[model samples]
Target: MSELTTLARPYAVAVYKRAKETGTADKWSDALAFVTLLMQDEQLAKAAANPKANREQFSEAFLGLCKDHLDTEAQNFVRLLIRNRRLDLVKYIAELFNQYKAEDEGYIEVDVSTAFPLKDAEQARLSSVLERVLEKKARLRVDVDPTLIGGVYIKAGDRVIDASIRGQVERLAKRLWT
Candidate 1:
């Protein structure tokens, strides 16, 4: 995972820069997301890995399938990936590109895990609190983890706020053992 991100970062940065210069960051975001999903398809993965699959044919088929979503610049980007056999990096590239986009837009992506699903009001309240504390808008990726027992665990960038029941119990146990 780290290797892929390291390898894909330069390309992702290049794409993001181009999109920013062309004033098409949002469009490129959509195109990259579509391409990433297309590349993840089982059949496409098999074809991409097959030594016998004609590279030209595979490239044409992929472009044709995504014709509606891609513009000229996006088509060229896809071609570059295909030519370099870097299609596998599409997912990482999209992720990195999204990170760049979020930073440019002055927001941070956060992952929140809870024992139960949060209500809309609960989510909004949490978002408001996080934004106030973090001093940036928060884009949350929420998940339910029954093993958490109760409360919430939030991860934003390099910071973690673990208020889960399991986390509290672990801390108390560690202190007692020490």
Candidate 2:
């Protein structure tokens, strides 16, 4: 995972910089997503790995698969990826591009794992508190996990707040075992 991220970072950064400069982050987001999906096709992967595949032919086929979804800029981006033989990195590029777009839009996406579903009022209060604490617009994605036992597990970027009952019990067990 880390290796893929490291390899994809430069491409993601370059594309993001171009999109940021041209005010087309949203467009690039859609383009990258589309291309990423296309690259996931088994036939496409086989063609990409074929040493005999002509670059022009591969690029045209890729662009054709996309139909009218991509614009000229996006078409050129696809061609560049083909020329560089980096279609395998498209997924990571799209992920990083979305991350960049969220940061630009002042959005912080967080995941919340709770033992039970949250009520409307509870969700609202949690969002409000998270927004205040994170100092960015909080977008919460909640999941019910019975194994959590109680409380919540909140993850935002590299930070994780594991206040779940299972987490506490595990910590206590570890201390006692040590």
Candidate 3:
């Protein structure tokens, strides 16, 4: 994991820098996201990682798949990754690029899990509160997990706020033991 991260960081940085200069971070994000999707496909991933596959042929096929979604610069980026045999790192690059984009845009990526799906009003209220607490705009990825029992669980970077019914019960049980 560390090795992959180390290899991916430089590519992410370069992409982020290019996006910043071109004033096209959103476009770059979309392009990288498309690449990420392709890489996630089992067949395509296998083809990309197959050591016996001809490099030039695969690169052409890959770029062909990306033709509509990627701009010229992004196509070049894909070519560079193919040349470096780092196509497998597309997901990590996209993730790191998003981190860079979010930090620069004064936003925090937050995960909010609830026992039930959040209403639009609830989501707005929660987002507003989190923005205040985190001191950055909150970009929430909300999910519903039945195991949470009730209420919400929020995570941002290393911080976690557990307000779920199961968490409350666990805390209470621990206190009673003490």
Candidate 4:
């Protein structure tokens, strides 16, 4: 994990706890996403990263942009982050928060690296197959990696399935050498 992610984890956990208690995990997820998007603004990002910038001013401007999209709890959450100088970690926090939400909702995020791009039908089939094998609803994020040589490599949480041609060759080479 990145240093920022480690720092953001506690905040994400706090938000997640509130979300669970209020049964509004989805709302919190959306709010975090929206706040993260807003943070991408060039001016806002500069101000957020500037230690000399006025926290009150920055918080008001940030909250103003968020008031329409975020609930009161989310606004308060933003203020707390600003007060603690953690605005820059919003993206990581949002990511971790969403992952927590997905797990709670019985979904597993999967990363599939393949030598070639998959067609819509191919992606659907692969997703279905992964869901069956993993026994959880899979959310696949696909990437084309020519180094894979052929086939696919699947990463879901701590589990890795190396079905790629390059991976097979490396395994065979390792066994032969041993």
Predicted model with the maximum lDDT: 3
Residues 13-128, candidate 2: write the lDDT tens digits.
99999999999998899989888888788998889877789999988888898868898988887888789887888899898887888898999888999999999899999999
- Clashes (backbone N, CA, C under 3 Å), per candidate, total 0, 0, 0, 0
Clashing pairs in 1: none
- Candidate 4 regions exceeding 4 Å error are 112-117, 142-155, 158-178
Candidate 4 Cα lDDT to native: 0.92
**Per-residue error at 115 for model 4, in Å?**
6.9
RMSD of each: 2.6, 3.0, 2.7, 3.6
Q: Give the TM-score of candidate 2.
A: 0.76
For model 3, the local distance difference test gives 0.94
- Clashing residue pairs found in predicted model 2: none
| Poorly placed runs, candidate 3 (over 4 Å) | 165-178
Tens digits of per-residue lDDT, candidate 4, 1-178, equal 5899999999999999999999999899889989899889888888998999889998998888887998888999899999999988999999899889889999999999999999999999999999999999999999999999999999997799999999999999999999
TM-score of each: 0.84, 0.76, 0.87, 0.77
Cα lDDT tens digits, model 1, 75-144, are 9999888888888899999989988998999999999999999999999999999999999999999999
Could you tell me the lDDT of residue 25 within candidate 1?
Answer: 93
Model 1 quality (TM-score) = 0.84
Q: What's model 1's lDDT at 146?
A: 98
- Candidate 3 lDDT tens digits, 72-136: 99999998998888999999899899999999999989999999999999999999999999999
- Give the higher-lDDT candidate: 1 or 4: 1
User: What range of 10 consecutive residues in model 3 has the weakest lDDT sum?
Assistant: 150-159
Candidate 3: residue 70 Cα off by (Å): 0.5
